[model samples]
Target: MTQNKAAPQNSVETYTIYATSNKYNRPPPPSTVALHGMDLIGAPIDIRNHRFFHPPPSHLMSTTTDLIDKLKSSLAEALELYPPVAGIVEVNEKGEFYIAMNAENRLGTPFLVEIKDTPYVGDSETLSPRLDMLLPPSSSALAVKLTQFSCGT
Candidate 1:
């Protein structure tokens, strides 16, 4: 992960929510298995990485509320296209992990959205290295957390 020049004063988790794909009723083909049991290499690599998105300033909406609203809406649509992410990892009778698609009518719940407030400090020395504490892990197949800087940058 890239380091940010501006560390936060502290992060306070303010909001959280569960979001599903816009179209959860549609199921994949019967033969479709979102993910087959992971192999040694794949499982190790997957466990080591976490994906997060931070769009460029130019792409940001007028206000934080607008940006958050668009993000939530776009997320639902994106999940619809990539339905496998909405599926859960479970073991079969033979004891293997796999992404079970369409086994349930609803997509995984609690997409963990968090809003953080960081205080402004006159000098960089006051910033804390607690940015990583903004979001906690969720059981949902997907999660999103939004961190707001004190300067709104």
Candidate 2:
């Protein structure tokens, strides 16, 4: 004989829902997965597959061409360090070369260049995402730290 399951007399009443309520145990600190990006606002430690956008020059070799090249290199090197970026850098129709971080999404905002490809080819003074840093590895440690910050994040 097949048993027939009876429908609950009430919709929510069938479930106590205590797990979602205060009765639920506070989750233990994330052990295996340590949070990173939540400096305060609880942003994910690492924005995996998160695409940020920036636009490039109307002309590739314009004042912004150098900027675009830097973006490409920074992106490539970042991919080396953070291997999840399994995509290519794209130069869109408007002449802005941005990374195709995802299929439907483009990274960086209009004219807001990211510092993935730009390097510090320096007399070695400072680290501007766009400008070359003058200091070598020996001369400045902070230069490396400052330059390491992503401009668009």
Candidate 3:
């Protein structure tokens, strides 16, 4: 098995968080600051930084690093080869995963995505599985801040 997989260099992932109905039917936005996975202010930082962590029993930090490399490579062709708004990984939540953003992400509209687990997240992080999405341009970059995920494997 490979030590770590690399992410596409030019690939950009994105996540769509729907706000509660009472809260204007919006999940979380870039402004909604939160800890763990509650923030919806922009894009979930967790999905951006580290989608998942290596399983318990250290010695795979290198694997995570490799994920980054693979992600970069994936991005280079995302705009033309893959879906403009695609998810990167799967997480504890059923629908929680990374979303790839290309030239298709729009503003002032409800953006929904289907997240999936990548080989990288699967090879190194927890068994639960999680995704790391790439985002497109937003009306306000602040409206789509990324925090990178955190986990204990």
* Candidate achieving the largest lDDT: 1
Residue 57, model 2: lDDT of 43
Largest TM-score belongs to which candidate?
A: 1
**Candidate 3 stretches greater than 4 Å from native:** 1-63, 86-152
Report the candidate with higher TM-score, 1 versus 3: 1
Evaluated at residue 40, the lDDT of candidate 3 is 37
Whole-model lDDT, candidate 2? Answer: 0.30
Candidate 1 structure, TM-score to reference? 0.53
Instruction: Give the poorly placed runs of model 1, Cα more than 4 Å off.
Output: 1-60, 103-115, 119-138
- Per-residue alpha-carbon lDDT of model 1 for 85-149, expressed as tens digits? 65555556776556555546334433333343554333342233223433232234544545555
Candidate 3: tens digits of C-alpha lDDT, residues 50-142: 343444333543554454444443333332232222322223246443332322332222222222333333433332213444434332221
lDDT of each: 0.48, 0.30, 0.32
Q: For model 1, what is the alpha-carbon lDDT of residue 128?
A: 35
Worst 10 residues of 3 by lDDT: 106-115
